[model samples]
Target chain A: MNDMHLCVVNITFLGKGPYTFSVGKGECVGLTGKSGIGKTQLFRAITDLIPAEGEILLDGRASASFSPTQWRSKVTMVPADSSWWYDRAGDHFPVKHKTSLLRESCMLLGLEPEVLDWQVSRLSTGERQRLALLRALQNNPTVLLLDEPSSGLDAYHTGLMEKYIGNYLRQNNPAVVWVSHDPEQLKRVASREFRMEQHRLYQIK
Target chain B: MDVIALTGVDLGLAASLLLLLSVLSVMLSLGLERKIIFFGCRMTAQLLLIGLVLRFLFASGSLLLVLLMSTIMLLAAGREVQARQKRKIIGLSGYLISVCAMFVSSFSVTVLALVVIIQVKPWYTPQYAIPLLGMLLGNTMTGIALALDRMTDQLHGRRGEVEQRLLLGQSWQEASSDIRRDCMRTGMMPIINSMAAAGLVSLPGMMTGQILGGTPPVEAVKYQILIMFLIAAGTGFGVVSAIWMSGLHLFDARHRLRLEILKSDKV
Candidate 1:
C-alpha cells in the first residue's frame, strides 16, 4: 500500500492512438474491447512487455528511469494463456515464495497445495489460469495487468478469484488495469471502466 | 619419403565409381542420379579452384593476400550459417551476427594455434595459415549454424514461456537462460562426438590425408589430435559467442520479445 499511481500519457502501439489515462493507488480500471481490438497491446505497452511510444510514470517517476526488469518487477502481467516451462507446477514459483506464502496463495485461489506437486501438463486449463495469476500475485507487484484472467475459470473459481483480487487490491493498493470482455465482471470489480474501439480508448464509466 | 601424385587419368578412373553409383541410382529410380552428378561436378570444380588459389597464395605469401582469402572464407562460412537456419531473422543483422561471431572465434583460435602451438615462422604463412583457418572455419561454421537454428526455432516455439518468465520480473537473460544453454549444447555436441570417436570408431579424415601424404603415422596422429582439439575450441567459442550475440539482438531495449524480427521459412 505504498504511494503508487500509474499515469500513462500519449501511449501509442500497433497503430493505436495517443491514449492517455491514469489509475490511482488501490484503483482498478476495467478495459473492454472487441476481441482483436488492442486491449492486450495496451497492457503490453503499459507493462513494458513490448515496444511502444509513451511516458508511463509510477509514483511520478518515468518507466525509462528504471531498468526494464526493475519496471517490470513493479508492474506484473497475468496473460490469458499461461505458459509453463518446468514439468512440475511447483517449479515455476520463485524459491523464496515456495512454502507458506505459496500455500496461502493456493488457499486464496481454492487450489489444493498438493496441486503444486502435480505435473504441469496434467493441469486443467482452469488450473493453469489460476496458477498463472497466483504466480504473478505472489511477487507482490506494485501494478497489476490482468488480461482476461478469468477466461478459463468456471463460475466457482471465477468468484473465488474476484474475491481474492478484491482483497489483494485492498491490501496491496496497487494500480490495476484489468482487461475483460465480460461487462458484469467489470461492474463487480472495477471502479472505473473504459471501452476500446478503433484503436482508441473511451472512458465509459 | 616423397608422396605419390595422382595423374588426371587416375582421378577420372576414380570418378568412374561415382558414374557407377549414378547409373545404379537411375536404374533403381532413386532420384539421386542428378544430385550425384551435380555434386560430383561441383566438388571437382571447387577443389580445382581451391588448388589453383592455394598455389598462387603459397607462392606470394603476402599477409594481405592471406587475410583477403581468410575474409572470403569467413563470409562464405557466415552465409552457410545463415542459410542453414530453419527460422532466419529478418534483415542484415542476422547475417552480420553470424559473420562477426565466426570471425572472432575462428580467427582467434586459428591465430592462437599458429602463433603459440605450431610456432610456424611468420605465422601468416599461407600454407600453414590458410589450411588451419579453413579447418577451424569449417567446423565453427557448422557449430554456429546449428546453434543459431536451434535458438531461433526454440524461441519461436516457446515464446509464451519466455514472455511469461519476463512478465514474472525476470530479466531477459534470466528468461532466456534455458534456451541459450540448449543452443550452446547443440552447437558443441557434434565436435564433442567427433572427438570421442576420432581414433576409435574412425580414423579422422585429416589424419588419413596426412598419412596418405607420407607423414609418419605418429606425426600424423599428433597433428590430427591438435586439429581436433583446435576445432573443438573454435566451435565451442563460436557457438557461445553466436548465442550471446543472438540473445542480445533478439530482445529490444524495452525487453520486449520481438518475434516479428524472425521470418520463418521451412528449409
Candidate 2:
C-alpha cells in the first residue's frame, strides 16, 4: 500500500499528555503497552470518544471536524469487556446481514451458530469478546479500535481470532488500532506496531 | 348532614391513606427491582414526620408558622435535590440557585394567582397556601433534579465525541448541541407524559380533592386546569434554570470538565 493510502496521525490526551502515533487505511496497526499506559485513552482520543490535543486525519481529511455520531459510525471502538444492554445476542444484532456476519465471525472465532440465541448473561467471557468483535464489524467501520480483543479467549479461539482479523483486514482494507499485551498475537497479525511507554508512543519496527 | 362532626374521621382516613401510599411505594419499589428500599423507607419516614409537624402548624393557624413551614420546605427541597444529584454538581451554587428559583417563582405564582386573583380570604391559610406551595415545590424539585442528572450524564458520557467534533472545527456550542438537546428531552419527558395522561388515566390529586370538598365538577375542572398549567410552567422554569445553572457548573475557567465534582461519596 502507498504511504498516501495510510496517513499518519498524532493523538494527544488531556492538554499536555504525550502524543500517540496512528497509521492505516485498511491496515492493521497493533498498539501494545502495559496496562494503564494510556492505550485505551489513545483509542478513545483517535475515535473522538474523549478530549484530545492532536490531529487525526483519514485520507488527508482531518477527523476533528466530523460529528461524533459520524466519527463513531466511521471509526468504532469495541471495548475488551463489552457490556450488553440486551438479553440475547440476537437482540443486540439489529441489522439484516447481522446473522451472516455473526455466522462468518463465529466460524472465524470458533463459536457455534447456536451461541447467537444464547442469553448474554449466559455467554462466557471468550464468547462475549468474540461477539463484541462481530458487532463492531457489523457497522462496517472504516477504522476499528480493538481493546484487548482476545483477552478472554483460549489459545484455540485466540488462533481463530488471529486468522479472522488477518483475513478481514486483507479483504476490507479498513485500518485497525488493535490493543494487546500478547507478543505472539501481535507478531501474527500486525503489519505495523507501536508500543506505548511513559505516556508516549514509540513505533516498533 | 353534620359533616363538620366527622372531622376526626376525616383526619383518620387521611392518615390511613398516607400509610397505604407508603406501603404502595414500598411494593412499587420492590416490583421495579430497585435496591433502594433504605432510601424509600427514609423518604416515607421523613414525609410522615413532616406531615405531623405541618398538622401542628396548621392547627396553630399562625402566619409565622406558615412562613417557617415554607422555609423548611424550601430547605428540604434543596437538600433533596443535592442528595439526588449524587453531589456531581459543583459547589453549593447550583443547589442554592435551583431552590431560590423554584421557591420564588412557584410561591409567588401560587400566592398571587390563588389568593390575590381568586380573592381567597386569610391568604396565609395553611390549608390553601401550604398544599399549593407543596405541589409546585415538589414538581419543581423533581424537574430540576432530572434536568441536572440528564445534563451531567450526557456531558460526561459523550465527552470523547464532543472533543472530536471540536477538533473537526465545530464550535463548542455546535459540538455540545446533541448533549444539550438530549438532556432537555430526558428531563422533560415525565412532565410531558403527565400532561398527556392528566384527566384520562387518573384524576389528579388537586382535582379529586376539590371534588371531594363539594366543588362543582366544572369548577373542579377549572382548578385542575389551572394547577396543571402552573405545574407545567413551574417544571419548565425549574428545568431551564437547573440546566442553565448546571452548564455553569460543568466547565471550569479553563473550559475543561471539572471531573472531580462527579466523585462525591455521598451517593
Kindly give the number of clashing pairs for every candidate.
Answer: 0, 8
**Residues A87-143, candidate 1, lDDT per residue (tens digit)?**
999889876544777787788898997889899999999899999888887678999
- Show model 1 residue runs off by greater than 4 Å: A1-4, A95-98, B23-31
Candidate 2 local lDDT, B1-267, one digit each (tens): 121344767766765765666678677774532334455557768977988987997898899999998888888898887777754666677668668767765777778766766566788888778888889888888887777777776776766545534333344565566677677676677878898999889789888877777788899999788778878887777777677666666654323344556645453
Chain B TM-score of predicted candidate 2 relative to the true chain B: 0.76
lDDT of 2 by residue, A1-205 (tens): 2354334445566643466455666678788878877777677666665567666776677765666556666777787767554578766653655477578668768989888888888999998888878877776777888899999988888888888887788888888878889877888888778887765677786
Residue A169 lDDT in candidate 2 = 82
Total clashes in model 1, counting residue pairs 3 or more apart in sequence or in different chains: 0
TM-score of chain B of each: 0.96, 0.76
lDDT against true structure, model 1: 0.90
Candidate 2: which pairs clash? A26-A173, A26-A174, A48-B160, A49-B160, A50-B160, A64-B167, A64-B168, A65-B168
